[model samples]
Target: MLKITHNTISEYLSNRTFSSIEKIQKENNNKKYLLLLSFLLLLFIVVQFLPWTQNIQAKGEIVSRFPDQGPQTVQTIIGGRIEKWYVKEGDQIKKGDTLVFLSEVKSEYFDPNLIQRTQEQLNAKDLSIGAYENKVSAIENQARALEQALIIKKNQTQNKLVQAKNKIEIENAELQNINKNNQIAQNQYQRIRSLYQKGLKTLSELQEKELKYQETLAKVSIQQNKLNNAQNEYYNLELELSAIERDYSEKIAKANSDKQSALSQSLEGRAESAKLRSSVSNYSQRQKMYYVTAPQDGYVSSLISTGIGQTLKEGEEIARIVPDKNNIVAQFKLSPQDIPLVSKEGKVRMRFDGWPSLVISGWPETSTGVFEGHVIAIDQFLTSDGYYRVLVQPNDKYKPWPIELRMGTGTQGFFLLKTVPVWYEIWRQLNGFPADYYREDSPETKKK
Candidate 1:
């Protein structure tokens, strides 16, 4: 129990009162500081709600339209050494115009019947014993080969006969004309000779007419000789072709007889050779298909420096042809960050490389010296140069298009993403950020 004085009590109460008042003042100052800090934070957050524009910048070039199949890369269908070139660079050509010719390559035709025939002969070899098996089989193969050879030769000779006859017909027409001219010259020479004798024409004139008559006669004989030669060729080919056919038939019959004998003997060798003449004929026609022709009406823009005698692989590009049609696509490159913002439906604003980049950084709506475009597509992956690819088409919505547009011209594209509050963008920039969420959501909802 401490004794209490009235004055001491009053002094102690005064001191305690002073202490309480100081503590209250300190607490109020702390509250004021906290209130000021909170107000500043609120101001920063509210500022993020202001409007801002965001866009992706990219560089690219104008390219042929995808619908036109783009610029064509003409390639060879068959692999062979180039034999001839029909079109030069910059030459306009129609569809089916031959551009390149390749050397003809030999091809073998499949024949099942010949194989069966050979097998029959080989089976027949079994009865002759082991010593003659190889010999018999070889002979059978040789006979089969010879048979095919004779058939091919007969066909070739027949073709030759037809060609020779056609030549003879042509020569006969020429010979008829030559004979008429010769008769005219002879008549003229007789008249000149009579005139010379009657003293109406000089000896020099008569001699000249005689020489003309002889020359015409010589021409007639020459024409007749050509016709006779053609006729002789036709006759010889016809005879040779007949002989080959007869020999081929006999050999085939003998081979069949031998095979019948060998079936009892029971030895065989397999020969897979041409039994179908259709395949052979088709291959012969294809041999002429070594020439590469233009797929459509186009102009030869360029060709490989490799010329005649240079071997090209199948599907190898020999030249490039630009079609007469016009369809243009602006091709451009994007960065990895810009890829997500671009969509097929999204719009693009392009400033051609030659065209000024009249692009104001923040406000694309007020863009000048730029053209409107619609996004076409985005590439599956980045290019080798670490840039992504994006295709866009000209919108031409704002005004009439510029006249200087062309393929392969460089372009700078502004890939517009979305509109968001400037305040939100600043806040996002301060931290890490997601895409503009304000524009992604509805206006009323965002406001709420």
Candidate 2:
């Protein structure tokens, strides 16, 4: 039952009118403020269209400059105390050169045969074992020569005996001729004497015939004695020659027999020495297992030894060498999201962090141009920062640009992601969608 008087009505209309005016004024002010905000927003959008406004990717050098060069470590063929180092660090070496020396622990690492033979010699306690072997070999050669000489000597002795017999026969023939002449002379003398006695010839003729017969008789006797002496001398010479030759033959035979026996002894000694040497070598080799050696050439980076001369357990990493240049691998990490785009054959560009604008083409330094390379592997484990690692093998055909371009050059890098179209960027802005949406579908289609 509230009364509605004429004044109340009038005042209420006034209040309504006043309130409508305030509302109208607020709306006008708000419209102007909104227009100003729109102007500022448009100005911002226009600025992005200017050429200077764009996001660039990252760039830098590799892990370091001047990668370390080291020689491959040569290990002991059979391990033992580092008996000695033949070449110290920084020493130049040739192929097949012995860089390190290892003294045998117990005289066993020599040739097995050599060691065994040495042991045999030791057992015999004979310093002459080696000398005996040489003597035997020399004697064997001498025996062969002597045998040949003995054969020739025997032939010569037989020839001398035959010549002596021929000389005796000739002397006997000469004596027989003289006896026949003497007989003829005697007959003539006797006939002449008988004629004289019958008075058919003079006394002078008989005397001359007797004188000639006497002279012929004397000549016959002298020739007979000469023949006898020649026969005796020939026989004596033959006997003496036979005796001398027999003595020589016996001496030569004895010498050859002695030589053979000595040679046999020498051969036995050699065989025994060889056996002992082998045993010593085997023992030396068995002891070698306790020793350790470098696998490749490198700088020793770490040593896990308890002290300078402490013994290490088997399989222990007593020391480590920073591997040589060939073993250097460029390691890098990227987010898991980037892994799918990367593969074993993916191409990548690299820059060292320390040296800006310098990209190492996987090529080696010996090449004329930047090297081409391919991805070799990806680490299965992720880093603490949730990044997976990758390994790239430089091309072998070309040398790398320089050590300045290799790993540990402190180089930082970036991989260029595929770019998006200009229209896609504009469309994304119009729809208020995420920038990534443009990667899958056009902004226009996504909005639809």
Candidate 3:
């Protein structure tokens, strides 16, 4: 019985030991899975603390740095039919190089000798102006001659008046002497008659006194008549002087009127000539316009008006030219919320459409096939597509852009901003918050 009891105890112990070993093995296997899960959790927490570069992504197209350096359309200002083509698509040309020759399409400019005919008209007007000028000059000379004649005639009339006045004075003196002689003869004749009556004088003496008295009376009458004639001659000289002044005045007035009329006509002719001259200049310039020239040195990209003999209206586009291609830039549009985050001189990473690239959004150092650039400009106004525009250019401190880059090529740009921990970035994104705003000179950025 003792032996059987001991054996049973041993068997029981052995079974318990085996069961415990199995349970231990199962626990160890479960611990192995738990340890792996804990290790993965710790690794994820550490990765969340890693640095991440915050960036804004935008799609854009390559363009010229300047508007004038971009593709431009060539146009004409006058209506015409294309006569000949001096250049074709893809031809490189300099400024002022003729691209096309055109012929007049309007009737007003159809004359083959339009400029020459206009010039002839201008010349004829010039001749008319010259003739009027000469007429004005001749009229002026005539007026001056009339004035001189008036002065000379007035002087001659004045001289005649002086002579007449002198003659009147002489005649008046002779009349006074005759009157005195008559008085004396009258007195002697009376005395002779008294003597004859008293018989104290002879008949011959009385007769002689009578005859002398008569002769004195005749002399006085003749002297008075001469004085009257001299006075009449002075009056006639005054009238002739007045007539000379009146006649010359009329002549001078007529001459001055003629001069003024000629001057007016000359001025009118000059005005007409000025109009003709303007027309001639316009025609000459129009003739030059027949040859459409390049506006700048460029390659002809396309021809809008192609066929010879095709008619084009005024201000019609003729062709397109692509100017310098060296100054290429990327134009990107950003949302309104992103405008405040973008600034001039901000760093950017770009991936061209045709180039293969592997992008790690938060790890720029790990990115491949991406080019570096910087913000050169930002638009103050919203674009037509309801977004703000930003301009990015190649960063000189980075690798040069691909030479195969062409204008209008598609580009994807990443505008880099402040750096932060991956956890914070993820948290901010979860909360719909903007990236942390930091100035370029901030200590936090400098520390990075």
Candidate 4:
């Protein structure tokens, strides 16, 4: 009985020792797992505090930074039929290079020598204007000659009037003298008769005095007639002077009327000539418009009118030209809610289509195959798609953009904002909050 009790006690001791060893081993294994879990928790906490760049995402396409350097559509100022093509699609051309030749489609411009014919018409009009000008000049000269002739005629008429007045005065003086002689002779004849009656004078003497008295009377009558004739001649000379003035006035009036008519004709001809000149200039310009030329250095992207005889309306688009890709930019569309987060010169990271990229939304520094750019412009108004457009250009401070990039290529852009803790970004994103507002020149940024 004592031996059986001793064996049972030995077995119990051995089992106790084995169970203690297994417990110790299990405790050691649990301690190692606990240490590993603690290390992992500390690592997670540290990562949350790491710096994260807040960014606003956007989608866009590549375009030209300058409007003039963008795509342009070729058009014609006047409608015409395509006569020939100087270039095909995708042809590189310089400014003023002809793309197509057009023929006039309108009946008014159908004549092959339209410009030359218009020019000829203009020349004829000019010649007609010159002839009118010459006629006007001749009429002016005639008016001057008529005026000078009138002055000469008036002077001659005045001189003739003065001569007539002097002749009349001389005749009046002769008549007065004859009358006086007659009176004297009459008195002598009466005295001789009285003497004869008193037998103191001879009859012959009385007869001689009577004869002399008769002669004096005859001379008086002749002188009176001469005075009347002189008066009549003076009156006729006055009438003649009046008639000359009237005749000259009529002639001058007729000349003035003719001159006015010529001047009016000249004015009309000048107006017509001016119209013709304008027509000629317009035709000449139209002739030059027959050849459609490139507005700048570009490649012909497309031809809207392909057929040789296709007719184009006025101001219709003919083809599209893609200007040389000298200054490429990414045009990004941002949400209105995020517009306030972006500003001019804001840093941006772009991933172009067909380029491999790995992006970390909160850690842009670790991103690969992404291009750097800066915000150059932002639209004040919303775009057609209800989003604001943001223009981004290559960052001069960093690497240049890829040369193989083409216009209209799709792109994904992120506008970098304030740096914050990853925990904050995660919290804000969870709460659907916007990025924090901060100026680039803020005191905090400057200090950093």
RMSD of each: 30.5, 14.9, 8.2, 7.4
- The C-alpha lDDT values of all candidates are 0.75, 0.56, 0.91, 0.88
Report how far residue 310 has shifted in candidate 2, in Å: 22
What is the alpha-carbon lDDT for the whole of candidate 1? 0.75
Model 2: per-residue Cα lDDT over 127-216, one tens digit each: 567677677667766666776776776677677667767766777787788778778888888898889999987899999988888888
Give lDDT tens digits, candidate 4, residues 184-259: 9999999999999999999899899999999999999999999999899889888988888888788878878887
Order of the predicted models by TM-score, top scorer first: 4, 3, 1, 2
For each candidate, what TM-score against the reference? 0.44, 0.35, 0.73, 0.75
- Candidate 3 backbone collisions, by pair: none
Better of 1 and 4 by lDDT: 4
lDDT of 3: 0.91
Cα displacement (Å) at residue 423, model 4: 3.5
Error of 1 at 208 (Å): 99
Instruction: Count the clashes in each prediction.
Output: 13, 53, 0, 0
RMSD of 1: 30.5
